[model samples]
Target chain A: MSGAGEPEVRLLGSWASPFVLRVMVALRLKVVEYEMQQETLGNKSELLLRSNPVHKKIPVLLHNGKPISESLIIVQYIDEIWASTPAILPSDPYRRAVERFWGEYIGDKFSQVIRVLRGSVPGDKDKMAGEMFTALQYLEEAFVSCSQGKQYFGGDSISYLDIAAGSHLAWIKAVEKISGIKLLDEARFPNLFAWADRFCAHPAVVDVMPDPDKLVEFTVKHAAMCAPK
Target chain B: MSGAGEPEVRLLGSWASPFVLRVMVALRLKVVEYEMQQETLGNKSELLLRSNPVHKKIPVLLHNGKPISESLIIVQYIDEIWASTPAILPSDPYRRAVERFWGEYIGDKFSQVIRVLRGSVPGDKDKMAGEMFTALQYLEEAFVSCSQGKQYFGGDSISYLDIAAGSHLAWIKAVEKISGIKLLDEARFPNLFAWADRFCAHPAVVDVMPDPDKLVEFTVKHAAMCAPK
Candidate 1:
């Protein structure tokens, strides 16, 4: 019991990163008390480097000075370390695999949406937009199958899959605004839109997400900086 | 002990897939007997769809009725199920995290190499080759740091990281031959080169890998068929 009392949890993160937000949401959902150290990308703290030397990226979770990097891996680590809690993944093996499949699909396809936002040339932008539309169409189909009259990606409650997809909502909205294109057509994907709403409204998710207005401002400013002179 | 006498494991895979080869190597390493069903990409088998309905891709490892997908996840599942023998991952959390870091890094960077192989035009091929070379340089640096003075990626005895990276050797070699560009310079990255050789020679890896001559022949023939006219 005393051993449990002394275990320290620390998170190194930046506010703008959705990856960091995923870990934050998982910690909040698990009710794990942790210290947060906001890292500056320009002058990264030595602790962050020591924690995650290879990637040297933020969102490093330190459990008793043992660091785990990679946002998804950190989330899984949190779930494993704090096993006596509301499970973030399904108990059934097949269901857990299903959750993982959705998480990976989101990861693999979401980059195309970002690519479109990052594009400068009209032709390149159009090509990427078409790819984004195709990805969204696939997502619509997947969500229809996954939702199956459930409130969340993992069914009744928010799970890791929900966190994985929901974390990108801020970035997605940012890209939509920057590109002046609406990919998440509500009429076309009502269930997916509803799921996104429920996912955003979830207490754990809501608490950790970056301010939408600030995210939009950052995205627009960044886009302007990258725009052809 | 009698529980070990359960139904034989079955793998649904494509011969050319690096992902499938990872599972094949793992199964071989563990000395577990299994059946292999090669899946056709054009018309997937019903069992493949039934086993991994979400992703619907190889490789899916079916142990009795339970299906595990995602090559890395399947590797973990195999490690957990066969806990009585040689551990594929390090027991220490930090080391395990390091192993996973390399696994994810290889996965993230793999597409650059694939892109190089898939490029059509001379200019595009050259650009892709440069990208692949840069990615290989990073791998070389990583190998220098991680495998310094060690026989294997996990330091003696092929661990999951070795198996994960090893699966790509045939593809890498094939790409080199097909693209007429070699990224893994033996002079520049002796450790990585030696590691690759050792990985290929390992009995488990050696037994499961598609023959190198056949791999190069198939890849060259496939490239000709798929190349943009």
Candidate 2:
């Protein structure tokens, strides 16, 4: 299906971008062939610039030379274009809207994770941890409602919500280990905790995830760069 | 299509919210009958709280008692469920995805408008105006590319992208009046300027838009509230 004259798939991405990993996971899940064009975040390539002029961020999915930027949008595009079995998004529009709602909720948590990491000093730990725990409670409820005892988030198969959450799972573990924030403890967020395990174990997501140690190191470095020096 | 046995549509919205007006515009465009459940944002009603616990903000669309929060999400939901005649979102998934991409871009501008408002002062006028002008230039290009000699954003009919842009048009004018930052002047942004005028002239969007004078008054009041006293 993806022979010459077919759509040429190239992923312009950086190793540090969870957004990039999301496109990778989606592509793998759909069994779409693509080349990963690595781009540094600090010094983005001219190709990356030409691909995505809007935000100029990475994880640009280049299909037949047309680039789609924004990680979530790219994931949806992949879901639509690839149109393989085990659709990540549900068929019914209402159900699709619900999955998208969860995706937006997960995206919101991404920013909160950054704030938690940045403000993870000893004095601010309790406050940040409290916020993180409250947010996790919401995610756990979302998982419980969607899963109904299933392994993944909304269904037995990894749905849109699962991928949305999966993108952040590695970061959660790395943050928990680095900041001692206890993001996804099984005792507290059992449903989500289990969901994370199932998501990461998938070959589609497993190999693409950044090493936890390297991720934490990068986070620390980013935090230092952002510090009010 | 929407009648007895169908879940009653109740909108939790504030008169001040452009986001609320967005849902209102979409619903009106679809000719769907929905009761406006006005919300006082400061002392939010329990319905608003329950419907949108995450943000606890206005513009939650309740259909048959099930709630959908987030303006754009509600817009898409409205477009989906009320698929009788005039389709706001395009049917083709690629076209729909492109519409969504622009919707996200316009939404991004909504926040930048707030930042410009908060940061605007006599000393910061040129800098703020420059940023606003640059953003408007992008919107102009988007309209030119998408319209392709059409009246509305996507076509002659009011589209999802047009609704996205229209929701903020009233506020954009009000902000310019209040801050005196010429954003969509015809010389710089002729396409966007013409588009805004057309969007406001639409019967569905016309009545629902917050009054310019009142909107400016509210915006001034809001700026005062945000100032570090």
Among the numbered candidates, top DockQ falls to 2
Q: After superposition, how far is residue B129 of candidate 2 from its true place, in Å?
A: 2.5
Give the residue spans of candidate 2 off by over 4 A. A1-7, A115-125, A220-229, B1-7, B115-125, B220-229
Q: Candidate 2 on B1-229: residue-level lDDT in tens? A: 3567655898988887778888999999999888888876467898788888987887888888888888888888888787886888876666666678878887776656645663443345566567667777877887887778999876879988888877887777777786766677998788888888888888998788888789778766766876898
Over A1-229, each residue of candidate 2 has an lDDT whose tens digit, in order, gives 3567655899999887777888898899899888887886478899888877877888788887777888888888888887878788876666677778878877776656644674543345667667777778888898887777888775778778778768877777787787766768899777778778788888888888888788888777876876797
Compared with the real two-chain complex, what DockQ does model 2 have?
0.53
Could you tell me which 10 consecutive residues in candidate 2 chain B have the lowest summed lDDT? B114-123
Q: Which ranges of candidate 1 are over 4 A from the true structure?
A: A1-12, A35-57, A62-68, A114-151, A155-157, A173-194, B1-9, B40-57, B62-69, B81-84, B114-151, B175-191, B227-229
The TM-score leader among the candidates is 2
Question: How is the predicted docking of candidate 1 categorized under the CAPRI scheme?
Answer: acceptable
lDDT of 1 by residue, B112-203 (tens): 56645744333466666676666667667766666667878777787878877888888777777766677678997778898898899888
